[model samples]
Target: MRVEDGFQPVPFQEDNPYTSDPVLPSLLKRTLPSSAFQEINPDLERLGADVVTTIRPLGSSSRVYPPRLTQYDQWGRRVDDLETSEGWRDLKAYGQKEGLPGIFYERKYNEHSRSYGFAKMLLMVGDVHVVFCPLSMTDGTARVIELMGSAEMKEKILPRLISRDPDVAFTSGQWMTERPGGSDVSQTETVATPTGVNNAFGPQYTLNGFKWFSSATDSHVSVALARTGSPKAGSRGLSLFLVPLRLPLLRSPSDPVPPATSNNIFVHRLKNKIGTQIVPTAELSLEGSEAYLIGNLNEGVKSISPVLNITRVWSAVGSVGGLRRCLAIATAYAKVRSINGGTRLLQDSPLHVSQLAAINVLYRALTHLTFGAVRLLGKSECGVADADELRRLRMLTPIVKAFAAEKACAGMEEAMTALGGAGYMEENGFGRIIRDSLVEKIWEGTTTVLALDLARASQDPAVLNAFLSWVKNVVSSCPSDLHERLQKPLNVVNDAVSELASSLKKPIAPLVPRPALILAGYVTSSTYLLEHVIWSHTTGEDERETDVEVLRRWILEGGMVPATEDVRRATQDTDARVKADSTMIFGRSSRAKL
Candidate 1:
């Protein structure tokens, strides 16, 4: 008799998270100095194996149980500590030692630092159970401070932020949202008034406000926005301040506290989030909190751009990490799966093979797209990027961030289905995979917000030239037969770009148009895959076969629904769309029961 519960392997290999990915090695090889990345490749690859073998299983259990808020000690001291499983702390230690988060700051790695750093981050997030959350904001905060902080701020904070030393290491908070304003930072009511206080910690501003969504609430320091000028100045009027959770207490005779203590940041409550449960996100009440301004006063909105962009990339990487893990699970399950008779391997089933392959195609293309953006980030930061590369890098950010998150949601659902009922069971880990990936679509910025940002970037001439010219060059470079193979999708994509340009000519266009956003992302992602594969072929790297398979699946095989001619037609007819939208939003059905 066969046991019903004996089958553990899904369609995926259950392989090491790092080396198992067919895409990562070649990508790093191409984007980074081969010598630098290759030197570290074995180490990262082994780390990847270690993560799969050790860290992930630990995370699966630890994140499920999650950390709890211990509001007080047994003696009734208000410690406000978030107590977590040892595995959680272990992952943090791994981060410090491996330089997983700080690798982005290592100029020794040359222009490839972002590529190599994010490559490690991509693998780490897969099964580290959203440990990427704090790391993402931490890296972003470090970058922001490095770029805009006063010399003193840099001297005081940068070392700790980038330090691999456990004793000196720090993570940071991004406290941007208030209860009333989600993405609208202009509506932030947090107030910062100069205390007329100056001491060893530099200038001080007293902050009083409520922060609604403070991710990494346990962080030692944070960057926040508050109105330092007229409330009417909106986002432009706000200032960016680096608020340390615990500040150095001046031992003045007039002061009530010790030389170093809590900076008056009170944790009001922890959010019981459906996803990213492992992260200690909380609501905060700041009363007379002290902070130092990081950038120009009232340029807070602009100054925070570096943080926003970097974090969004991490969000994209994290989305792919979740999808990659799910696919790994699904692929392993399919290999040993059988009919009730136990005679036929699910791997031999044509339908099953095709299903997994379809998702793999997406995984491959998105991996290239996301990593390509990282390469551009490094180039731009290192001052090697030309005008065109800079424009592409700038625009590619929103496109990749939104696209990866959207596909991760779709991919995880398919992953769950492939694993049968066990996928829904908590112990199998698919519950967290799907649940965690769901928030990816919501975090950083919702799809609509990112799409709008993408759309705005598409209209600029430099961006347009950078994108269109590259697409044309890539498609045009294909040898005659291969070029012919790509012609239809290329034309379809170019038409979408042309339409976008035409629409932008009209002053009354919506900033957030779904069709335009979808078209831009699909076209660019497809092109990135095709171009990379072709480049590999010319250089003798041998990825062209798989690359062609992905291109045919996503572009030529009618895989992208919104990129089709029909959707394009529907979007162009503004009058009909308006009427349909009005009927849907304003006019209910005539036979409505309500």
Candidate 2:
């Protein structure tokens, strides 16, 4: 059965079920180069230190904020007061000055409970929930550019935004994804009719349409995508507007600012999601809402891509951090937990050793790839968008999100196995990790969606050719002495790609398990490329050569070949293989279905 078919809560046990293996930790430690630890060690320490400070004061028995408390006490109270102009004024005044909340706010809002990790980090403040709806009315960042573009708007808004006791907070909401339109901005039905000038800030537009799933729903300003051009104009016709949730006033020292107003933007409801629950995902209705245009009329999508690209990288990093945490927790637990009456869990078993070893490789490879992608993103020229950089982000985003999340879930499950029944309990945190990690794959995009994207990217001659060339370049750059060791896996990837290309022309049936195997091999190949690049750069050529040899022999002699065979069998066979020979012929099939 698929891991997600349903939660079958098994009873917690006191003994390890994976056998009396004691070499797991040592085996894992041996496989990872000391250097891999060097790069991440400091950061992990810093994070640990930070967590100590953050969570220590809360005490050991404190629980994540309850969802009902957040809803009834926080959101409800804020909304009821928000119904008043005075309440609106207070929120705007406070938000502008405080810069909103951090992780603390998320904990208050039950976002941790809801699963909005990063978003909660962005929004949550001390004990109270801070609202972000109005501030996100405009494309918060782009609005800065637009306001700067006009000296009048700048004079009016910039000072308060920059002021020590600012009265307004600027946040942005991404509202382009529609129910029926697959990320296609042009197919949006939201309309913005030209409304008469509000005062003298040029032409004002009245937005009247539905915007589903806006991030930063509590912000005061928002940049909303509306149909300003021809309805049939596709993406080019879609224009972005700075929608103000509250009326704006000139930045005057003497004048009394009026109470904040909600305009006509109404929230339909908040989304119940697998993760990122702290940041409210709201369906909004903009009914004759006041809005001003930012940038040229037909360039909204292009303008948004830059910001989205940066956010994507941040998301990738967040996933990596979570995954790393899972690994660390699992490994640490395996090292300390005793299995039987006399022996530690990781001290004596070959199977346990093998599992931990495999996990270590996955963790290290993912870390290098994620960090490398981060570096690549950092290297791209600012302002000018590079398609190559974007493509790389696109390609890596899904892989990191999907693979890291899946591995994290698996790692937690394995860690639980090490703990016997204790790990399965809520108090142990392994169950939480598994619960939380499940959302990572579903978020950004499902694995199925990502696989399709990969398939499509492979079909684009330019993208496909470029990717293949890049892979070849990576293969060529491997240390000469380690070529023999790396050759088998590299060839496996090449053959798979060739076969995939050929299958594109035919109506190939679902390979079921084969796809997972192929995907694993591809990821392994990619990991090798990433690890080589990072290790080579961090260490000298000579050191990298040695490390490469070690990694090569470890991977080849390890379970990779058997794993591939298992994938092939699971995909092609209708019946289960019970015999050892049958299993070996197919490789190691996953006990857990996709």
Candidate 3:
């Protein structure tokens, strides 16, 4: 006889993420031509089902079996052998075969190909255990090589990076951080001396340095920054190089041991991170590692900017993906979950529904912001965009990246709480969602660091003009009746923009960088959301009511614009605020001012 164990919550059952999503298909249909939509939609639906049924289970297994590193052979030889779980390997191979990195280059739908690729990724990321981290770097590296690599380099590496054949495909690493400086690459101490040899890859150089953090340590090749000029040259002293992490894959087994094992790269240890355990990050020592110079010497910063832009976009999308997954689970659970001793379903409860509603608004807005930027990227890459579109993409990149990361972190937390005690449990999977989402804020760039970048870009007259003009154009295009319906929210965005533009003229821009960027993101996202509403009306869609309310709540309930008093305090009450803050932080023994 079994004893009763009280009531057990019904397990949540999530539908296909791609089909259950109300926004993605509509956005794609509105933006792409009918023929292009016809070509992509079916494939997206198939991928959507695969993510839930196949990819998700594999991802869970990956976390269960984390990677291991073996530093020595039985004979006492120094061999840094990194071993990953079978599930991780299978998922990676699956992603490669499905064009995780190749879709961007395939151009099957021309400019729309990026949307197809990103949409597929958006669905897959919810369950891939962050395998996308290394693949993100691979995508960025491909872009760099395609745009900047010499003929030999492009011919050799580009094919493998974009290969659909899993056995032949390659993933790349980005090794930029050093012990002396994390984000500050200007202080890089790595030295690269010319080896005076030209190989199949490119001109050879020997890199000798210690890299503090190398994400995706198991990659085949990496793009690194090393000083090739005077140490005093700051960022200008750094030059970009292509460092192969392993010997040529096609080499015969008896090819003289390839001169050095692991291409003279030694992995000190894998990082014990809070999330993304599936990704093997490492501390590395490049001892006479063979590398090929990428572009003009001492122009590493300028050359690597393109890669940063691409990865930042990936960061934004990854954040939204994580939130969407948690929200879906929470939503599914609420409908069947009962309260009041089975008298009512959780979804029927007003308070619970209200919390879910707020999170939905945030998720929708972030989706628009992230995908809007992706569309601009596609246009710019296809060489079809005019000057203003390019400028808008540049401005939107950091703003969307910073804004989405911060909001998604908060949104995921709220989503977890919606599940009650089950959310706090490790087995339910919300733990992984929250932990992985936090990295989005730190990687690519921290919220504060990206806010500074936004400040610099907003100060540029051209970039500022491009963004403001876009907001005005989008808002003014709204139907007269719809504009009247959304008049209050419209006015809110308009006023916020005016105030931000005014603030940019003063020195307060630096002091209120985060708020300024966030305000701009809200304003920009409002425009995109408004544009979607307009599209719905024009197409005679039935979901216009819910769409309109989402926009309304985003402005009125969500606090799209920061308070003027807060901005004033940041600029005006700086000395008092700083002294108090420092006193509290330092135990009243420090003298500090803002």
Predicted candidate 1: what Cα RMSD to the true structure?
Answer: 4.0
| Tens digits of per-residue lDDT for model 1, 1-594 | 466566554434477777778788877777667689768789778888887677776665734456788777799877677666676666775776678567778767867888777777777776777767777888888888788777776777787788777556788889999987798898889999998876444567989999999997767688899888887888888989888877552233354533122788877778999988777888888888989887788999888888899898988888887888788888888877876578888788888888888788778878888988888888887889999999998788888888889877788788778877877877667787778878878787888887777667766777877877888788778777666766776666667566655544424245325555566677778778777767776677777777666677777553455554433464466665666676777685622432
Residues 1-594 of candidate 2 have per-residue lDDT tens digits of: 898685444333222211121222222223334554344334334433433353223312232231221223444532312222333334334444433222112223231211122222222111112133333222234333433334545555444433325433344556776665645566888888887675344357888888876765654456667887887788888777666655553434465643333476766666676543344566777778888766677777765554444444344434444444444545565665555653545636677766666655555455445554444443342223366655654555445545555554665566567656665766665554455446556544556665565555445556545544566566666666555656776666555445444443223334432354235434444555445634454455544554554455445653445545544554444344434445566655733331
**Alpha-carbon lDDT of model 3:** 0.85
Candidate 3's C-alpha runs over 4 A off are 1-8, 62-64, 249-260, 506-509, 563-565, 587-589, 592-594
Candidate 2, overall lDDT?
Answer: 0.48
Candidate 1: lDDT of 10? 41
Off by over 4 Å in 1: 1-13, 60-64, 72-79, 199-202, 249-261, 564-571, 586-594
| TM-scores, each model vs. reference | 0.91, 0.64, 0.96
Superposed by TM-score, candidate 2 places the C-alpha of residue 386 at a distance from the truth, in angstroms, of 8.1
- Error (Å) of candidate 1 at residue 191 is 0.5
Report lDDT per candidate. 0.76, 0.48, 0.85
Taking the tens digit of each residue's C-alpha lDDT, what string does model 3 give over 1-594? Answer: 345577866777898898998688888888899999998899889998998888888767534466899988999998888888887788888888888889999898888888888898888887877888888899999999999998987887888998888777888999899998778898998999998898666778999999999998877788999999998998999999988887664444346434225588998989999988878899989999889999889999988887899999999999999988988988998988999998899999999999998999999999998999999999988899899999899889999999899899899889899989988998778898788888998998888888788878877889889988989999889999999999998888888888777765546534678777777788888889999999888778888888899889888777665543345445556667767778888866587333
Residue 21 lDDT, candidate 2, scale 0-100: 16
